[model samples]
Target chain A: MAEDALRILVIDDNRIRASVIEQGLLEAGYSHVTVITDIEALMRCVVEIDPDMIFIDLGNPNRDSLEAAFAVSKAARRPIAMFVDRSDAAAMSAAIDAGVSAYIVDGLRKERVKPILDLAIARFNAFFRLQRELEETRSALAERKIIEKAKGILMQSKGISEQEAYDLLRKQAMRQNRKLAEIAEGLVLAAGLLE
Target chain B: MTGLRHQTQIALGFVPLLDASPLIVAQAKGFALKEGLDLRLLREMSWAALRDRISIGHIDAAHMPAPLPIATTLGLGSLPVELETPIGLATGGNAITVSEELWRHMRDAGAPEVAGDPIACGQALKRVLEACQKQPARPLVFGVVHPFSSHNYELRHWLSAGSIEPDRDVQITILPPPFMVDALEAGRIDGYCVGEPWNSLARKHGSGRIVTTKNRLWPGIIEKVLAMRSGAVDADVTRRLITAITRAAEWCDDVNHREELADLLSQQDYMALPPPCLMPGLTGELMLGDAPPSLEPDFLRFGGSATVPLPSQALWLYAQMLRWQQTSFSPQDAERAAAVYRPNLWCEATGLALPQPFSITTFDDVHFDPGQIQTWLAQYAACVE
Candidate 1:
């Protein structure tokens, strides 16, 4: 914990995530921290700053950050915690699950890598949890909108009460083994065509 | 009728490159429909995702670099999956483009007027880089689409040939194709090697100029292929999928349908670029210069020589993988993987007349042969090991 304040670079296309990671690293007592929103700027910063570790917040399924790590790893060979031995299956899996993409050069001591890696994993997992929750909320709201439109269609088409329409769609979804949202979407499409 | 009654739908992954024409053609032209398939093309952002999805069976097939199947078979991407390429998509569409500043520097360095020659351009560009490296500024940043791509290997080969060490002299980074022109314009990367129409698009955007095409680097090299999981190909569904792809490939080869093809690719669901941006690669008429830009067709090609899945091309790709230490497998692995280049399947699907001799050597201009291959691999393995 005492081999010079761990220099960290937190990169995220999202400004909020970058700020949160930057703040989190600062609160964790790592004084040297830099945050970058542009992916293009990251390579230069990495070479100049030579941070002890890098934490990238990549929400998209693309492997942009991972690809960058390969280049950085090959160029600088920095002893960052990210490029831990691929033979260490447990650490490798944990690192991937934690959403931390990493590369390590030769400068840093081997023993120092584990603790830094552990911290990065924790931070990434926390961010991912928050993101998943946000997505769930949005999807739920969209599904609600679809269900409402489908209920309105049923009310107009069959002259059914609101409660009765809901029951009808629910019964149809269960019978077809389809999600209520899917059945609702179909109902809405059919109604639009008919009208 | 029996096969159609139990038709299987398969999901395929693709990165939006000009070489992905086969998969797109199959989907758009009802080739898959004719064969009783519901083939879905899932556009991915990078080769890494496509490799991962195919490895995990999330995608039944993928449009991948010629090197990918062999690389994966050798467990280069951390997972081993048996893959086969029944149809070659397109070839000779990649090019190297450098920023305006770098281009100007090279022009002053007695860079020859070789027009489309990448090797000459690379040699000239290297001198510019050497002079610029005197100052302790950051290394020149170059971009490539993916690690296992032919563009990546070609860039490395061209750089090394110019006496420039890839990782040492310049920093090569991976930028998605869509972002390459913009990144170059912003001065983030000095140069990039990627497939069209991004190379052509960069010229149009006034961000950079095409230094040389891959056709100049290695003419008629197999660039991309339609890959399917070994398991997926065994199922009845593959016949229909291959049929759809074969028809699409023929449709693409028709010069009269060039505009229609461009229109299809320009949809938001596909390349998402303007039809004009996608036209150059398809029509073989790319504008590489500014003001009065000169037209350079052959920037992209589909069908004809592009469709032949030659074992020699597979061998060349294997050599690249070996050179990069991307795979641990030996030269024997290359021979084994080349077996997956199923020209017979292509004949069946296309109903094209076959040559009397089924096998053809892929070495066009390259000097290396299978015997030389063994010796080269042995020496390479010795150094790396």
Candidate 2:
């Protein structure tokens, strides 16, 4: 069978991560790709799609149900093997570390599935990196707001300029050997408690 | 003192359930710390994921179901890995819970009101299944945690004892423990056999009723084991883990620590359930439906003799695999399966006495002799064949 003719199914609860992999599969010219976000009807969906390969996020709890489904499918003579290339320990570990697992129908050549597995691992890693960066950016913005609030509180209470208030926070942080955010957060919490 | 100088960092994986208390308490209550081990407990969403994580060396060890190591060793489902069970985590926290509607149907079929009677309940279910086959014609569906789980084997044993053939009379599917209550509510599954907080939560939600427990089916049955790669972990580290977890298990089993254990387990990083949800399994004072709290002292046991990894129990689990057609009979494979549970390692680690072989007793009074498994398994030919 042609590689493009292989029907691929992706199951991920995270909608964004699912789309990232879905977009990658489609852009790579895999035409018969189906992404399933709702796993309530997972068994039925798997039967209906009859995908040649299944890419599932390792974090999904429904992965157990999928395992059971594959067991049933194996009984029906269409065995599905969890993607484990014992020879390529590095790739196997990389996929596991990236939280990506795949199941392929038996008789699919190794060379045929390797590219898809690589794509999934790459996509999943990219999505995870994107999520981490977004979280860091949000926390940084929140820290800036807290620091500003602490500066305002110091400027109002001590009758000092904004620069002096900033210096006070920096000095307190340095003296305590803590982060500036910690000092700002302590002041904000203390101010709220006092009120 | 020199051993305490270098702390071993171990990443232990587990599913969030009541039975994971030992691993949690080992870290939480300073037991692991006392052994100079920094235990990091990572909760996996599925057993498959946990097994994969451990396979690729992502995690050092896991709180695993008893039969999982055997199945993995036998290469039943996934790739064969040399997983070893140095210590049994806990025994008998699993319960078979049925939907409230199904419970009503079961009661109408002359099932007893009280719990802990597997034979009576199985007969009642057989009658109910006979009735269901008449009009609705749909087989009752039950969910288990994994294919290679005590929940699956025990549930199959219960159904087959009732003359109700599993997969034919009733469909046994796998559902994560967390999804069981919702599945019961949604009527996606008629019943499930899962570990605690799930069974208790289902009963509390008014969606399911407890029928029989692991202790009821097979008292002192091994449920979860501490599984790790056979030669991957250092022997000293493994021994220290055994000691720490054994101490934690004893603490968890004590009546005085029940409330505290529940509180610790209810924290966000562990089971994260209400303390009340965990109390029943810990105390064994289960509130099955509207009946008064049934006090089955042996409902769930930790530490003590429960910590011993019995090779006979491994054979019994391998027998279930054979009985259920999960794997075929092979003397070499059976040896491999039994070798998965290392009582000698347990003894060397904790200086604990290993339980006698072929000592496993069940509710049905079937004597399983590890010496004569072929002869003993002949009785089940009527079901297995």
Task: Identify the runs in model 1 with alpha carbons over 4 angstroms from their true place.
Answer: A1-68, A71-195, B1-6, B112-114, B133-138, B289-297, B325-329, B351-365, B374-385
Candidate 2 chain B has its poorest 10 consecutive residues by lDDT at B352-361
TM-score of chain A of 1: 0.73
What is the DockQ for all candidates, taken in turn? 0.15, 0.65
Please write out the lDDT profile of model 1 over residues B100-172, one tens digit for every residue.
8888888887565444565567678788887887866778889987677788888887787666778678988
Q: By DockQ, who's the top model here? A: 2
Q: Cα lDDT for residue B313, model 1?
A: 66
Restricted to chain B, the TM-score per model reads 0.88, 0.97
lDDT of 2 at B364: 77
Which runs in model 2 stand beyond 4 Å of their true positions?
Answer: A74-87, A147-184, B1-3, B383-385
C-alpha lDDT score of every prediction, in listed order: 0.71, 0.87
Residue-wise C-alpha lDDT for candidate 2, range A45-109, written one tens digit per residue: 88888888899988788887787777767445354545355326677788888988888877777
